[model samples]
Target: VKSQHSERCIDFLTKELKVSNEKQAQERVLFVSARETLQAR
Candidate 1:
């Protein structure tokens, strides 16, 4: 289910965040995940 969640996240990022390219989408994911991790602490 984790893979599905990843796809969903990517889809949401692409549609809502308006990330145009694969590389930017990936970077945005990494950045968002990192920020979430920090916020969890």
Candidate 2:
């Protein structure tokens, strides 16, 4: 039972990490595009 609980915790943490990474990637894309737009003006 203890092992099973730890496995679930690890899984949850991995999922949370993946979500944060995706958010960071999205923010980077947005920043790059905004910079490009500013340069174009």
Candidate 3:
């Protein structure tokens, strides 16, 4: 990533897409949190 891509690309892709090897883990966390938030309301 450091050698091939620019910093901007990394930042946008990471934050917007939440991409990487841990994508599944991150997605699960996001869904869990959303479910909790909805339940709270």
Candidate 4:
């Protein structure tokens, strides 16, 4: 169940952000999260 949700998130990120590969997707996730964290401060 959790894995399925994760897959969906990855797919959504790939489409929304136009990341071409899994490694890029992971990096994009990190970048987005870091921006969100700074914004939350």
Candidates ranked, most accurate by TM-score first? 1, 4, 2, 3
Alpha-carbon TM-score of each model against the true structure: 0.44, 0.36, 0.31, 0.41
What would the TM-score be for candidate 1 when compared with the true structure? Answer: 0.44
lDDT of each: 0.65, 0.48, 0.49, 0.61
* Per-residue C-alpha lDDT of model 1 across residues 1-41, encoded as one tens digit per residue: 55666677787878877755556765665424566779999
List the pairs of residues colliding in candidate 4: none
Tens-digit lDDT string for candidate 3 (1-41): 33233444555456777775345433434212556679999
What candidate 1 gets wrong by more than 4 Å, as runs, is 27-41
Model 4, TM vs. native: 0.41
Could you arrange the candidates by lDDT from highest to lowest? 1, 4, 3, 2
Model 4: per-residue Cα lDDT over 1-41, one tens digit each:
54565566677877776656666665544323556679999
Give the Å shift of residue 21 in candidate 1.
3.2
When superposed on Cα atoms, how far off is each prediction in RMSD?
4.9, 14.9, 11.3, 6.0
Tens digits of lDDT, candidate 2, 1-41: 54565455455545655544434444333212556679999
What candidate 3 gets wrong by more than 4 Å, as runs, is 1-5, 21-41
Candidate 4, backbone clash total:
0
